[model samples]
Target: MTAEQKGARLANLWDKTLAAGMSEPERLIYRSNLLGSDKRITNYGGGNTSAKVMEKDPLSGQAVEVMWVKGSGGDVGTIKRDGFATLYMGKLNALKSIYRGVEFEDEMVDYLPHCTFNLNPRAASIDTPLHAYVPKKHVDHMHPDAIIAIAASKNSKELTQEIFGGEIGWLPWKRPGYELGLWLEKFCLENPGARGVVLESHGLFTWGDTAEESYLTTIEIINAAIGWFEKKITGPVFGGDKYRPLPADERRKVAGALMPVIRGMISAAEAKVGHFDDSDAVLEFVSSNTLEPLAALGTSCPDHFLRTKIRPLVVDFDPTNPDVAGTIAGLDKAVADYREGYKAYYERCRHDISPAMRDPNAVVYLVPGVGMITFAKDKATARISGEFYVNAINVMRGSSSVSTYMGLPEQEAFDIEYWLLEEAKLQRMPKPKSLAGKVALITGGAGGIGRATAERFLREGACVVLADIDAGALEAASADFSKRYGSDQVRSALINVTSEEAVADGFANSATEFGGLDILVSNAGLASSASITETTLALWDKNIDILAKGYFLVSREAFRIFETQKIGGNIVFVASKNGLAASPNAAAYCTGKAAEIHLARCLALEGAEKGIRVNTVNPDAVLRGSKIWTGEWKEQRAAAYKMSTDDLEEHYRSRSMLKLSVFPEDIAEGIYFFASEQSAKSTGNILNVDAGNAQAFTR
Candidate 1:
């Protein structure tokens, strides 16, 4: 295909969106998704797009020109019509009248919300006014890495003019807001023929009469910038023959050893909030010979300071033969020195006599050649910040080949870091989910109850590691989870909880994957129905190994990790109602479950001093979607009830006072209460999720 044809093909890719008959807002969604789909353009929630469209106001039944800009907090890649906030164009323009006389920068935020034409409470992105200021029908804004690489450099203005000539308007670094919007508007009107505008230390903006034209323009400019950089810049910045990367296993070992220490140091000790997720690429980059000088240069741009802070904290360590214990020993002093250095930097650059400092802890931790660990309020944020730094490294590499990498000066970084408008933009983020920063380990995770609980914890924002004995079932369940809740949020381990080695390896994997554990759901089990007279030795042993011994093994390992991390956690056992009230032909099953409940109580007592909570969920006959409720055992239970399998299911439902069927989801809900802070003080408690089973109710 020719160049034009290829460009058309790429633009058409975004056309597969919404329904056939698309509204203007839906088209905006399609375009935003197109922009977001390319990582080179923007990371999740990093860019904004807008379109000026005429829509009928529901209340007035009159045509209104509303500027639908990308709303705050939604990933541009998955944005829908609702992702764009609709604002009255006339009202937004009216703000210009008072812009000239404005005294404070924060006053823009106070009045910006009032410009909304739609009654929806969604806040517009900080760049909404910038998009609104443009007179074009469609405007595209994005933080393309290639574009930012040049824009954030020391000679950004000189480079821009050399590359794009007078076709692109250049603006000095200005904190984004109402004043910036006014400045951009005046610049655009004066340079009407300019294809786009480059916002130094920020991002790029392009516009056209149609979405295709605007999107294509953005692609063209970014491609041009990337092409120019490739010609001007040369070779790898970090990797060399002298600096060897650690073997995969060694890297993982180092990461596992040092993550907890880094997590503890950077974390808010009182709140117990932090994420120590690692990246192999990041580790390699940090460990390379070129890291020392490159890291000190600061972020690629001012916009990133919110995520990456001013610069990374480089902790000294010997990567060749890592001293895991020694590294751990030095973390306190290393972090202390880092905080002192940061305070000194702040004091030297403060605009006021007593400026309020942001978090003194480092967001990105570079442990020389060993590895790199990033900490944030949660997994997602830490991952995003890591991404920004990786991009920054790339930008620095390119800029280094050409000349020295000069990022936003320290004063500029501090201004953006503590800017009230920027702070307010973050404050507008939606409230976090219940288990936002917690990590959960769910055993028997591919099974009915296990899968349900894994999903439940994920929905509440916890990073979940699903452990299952069946590798196939675990793989399938993991793929399903990765699709629904993102791969970062869920992981799987092939573990037989009955095996001491398997249990140990599984918890170790969990700690390595997510730094540490917060909640342990011991739900992996099997149901056995055999009378004492007819019970087989094999069946009794298998049941005891899984239900009784398995819970003990997993709980024991969890307790060890909890004590080591010093973050008191929770353990929830999936005991059955049979343990509470004995039933016929279930002697082995009842004995095993009874042992589990007693074990939980024992641990609850011992763990009390450490603030560890242990609780049990006694679910009775959870037939729906239960693996144990199928095959020969299910048939035997049906036979014992003297009814068909369907009838047996109904019988169990009718046995409950509420006449509701028990399900894995119901059991999961009970586990959630104990796992979360909802039951902060309720340890050793039995939550019966049998739909009001009086016999199973805790006395």
Candidate 2:
């Protein structure tokens, strides 16, 4: 490929035969998905596409013009037919009569429902008018980084003219609303030959006579920007990196160490999830000399800063010197200063109708040597926030290299951030689940009890990291949970709870992947049934190593993470009724269980002051779906009782005071009680789910 051809890397992905089969509205969906599939074209849920189509009116029995556009909060890339809102073209144009001016643009949002065609329940966004007034068969407005770099530059207007001549035009800065839509209409009328326009400090808008033309035009415009920057930007990007980035492993270690500390500070009001980014682009920007100054300008685009707060807090660790301890020590004051500064910004920009001040903590944190860390209400939002910041970094890289990079004016940013309409949108959101922002690490997580508990937590909106010794079970279990709960909410680690290093590494994985750990379920175990005289030293040691030492190793790691976060944590130990009741010929198993129960009591005493709670759940006769019972223990125990292995269940059921049998799910509920706030005030307590065994009474 030639240099110019190579520079234009974005391929026109439209399939002509496919478009030939789709209706106009279906074609709109097709075009929207094509444009949104690439982040370079638009960030997630950031852009809108529309198509004007002729449809048969159900009421009038005549062909009527209707505009189908992406609905509010819908991502174009994943949207289906139901995701677009249809509005009567006549009703939409009629809105122009009652439309006051820029000041009353927000009120126009109320009138959108009145223009609904065929009663599309999908609400229209504020950008509806922008597409409605374009006077074309198809229109697309996108936030591609390459185009936004020029649009966000100091001389964006001049750059547009120089790049595309009269075919594409440039418009001055105007906050998106009905007024901006009118401006677009006027621009189209005056410049009849124009194919598109660059909205200064905003994004690009392209139109065409067909859906294919409009989609292709959007791609070509973005590639033009990319190609121009490749040739025009000859200088070192981001003022050349001032400090070399740490090795990838070292960067991750620092991020893991810092995330829990930061999450603890910011998650006071509401639990927040964390996302870390040390991609090449992020590393380049965070380690650069101009990182501080450019970050101070914040972001030019509304979508960029909205998810990533108004500005990021630049961490004070110099990569060359590498003082992690010093950086952590100073974070207390650094966070306080950022919060105070944000409050001051709110106070200065508040209007009578403005919404109340939101969380003042920085959503984005720029650590020099490592990369970027973002925290939000949930994992998806947290991850998306990081992705948006990377887009901003790319835009800044280009604009700063060629022309002066600029951020949105503070007042405008404040206005948009605290806008009453935005506030209303937030209010419309549904209430969060019980464990919405909580993350858990379940040991022996591929086993029956652990799997049940993980599913329970996941159903309540918590992110789960399943750590198990069984490689095959872990993979299958992880894939199952990931399919049911989103992949973002589920992760797995191959961990031997008896190995201190493996246990610690599992906790580290939990911290970096989902911010930090909140709950630890120590469920890894193996049972041995043998008379004291018959039990070999190896059997005794194996029982103690896995059941007792394993629990200790995992809990120690949990305590370390919980202490670093300074956030209260939950540790639920799955012991056995054998801990209290004497079971014949299983001396080693009973001794190991007793040790596990006692450890819970000791840890509870030590953790009380730190708000960490340790509790024990004693389960017995959990015969169904149990890995331990499937082994020699079942035959050995049955042999000692003078019964077949099949009769062991009947023996246990008949021996119980309630004549009931226990299952893994029963133990799962007992553990859940301790993990949840339902048992918040009661710690160091034991809950028995052993079919009411009189011999196992804790009281």
In terms of TM-score, the best-performing candidate is 2
Model 1 local distance difference test score: 0.79
> How much does each candidate deviate from the true structure in C-alpha RMSD?
4.6, 2.1
Worst 10 residues of 1 by lDDT: 1-10
Alpha-carbon deviation at 541 in model 1, angstroms? 2.7
**TM-score of model 2 vs. true structure:** 0.97
Q: Which runs of model 2 end up more than 4 angstroms from their true locations?
A: 1-8
* Deviation (Å) of 405 in candidate 1: 1.3
Query: TM-scores, in order shown?
Result: 0.86, 0.97
Candidates in order have lDDT scores of: 0.79, 0.90
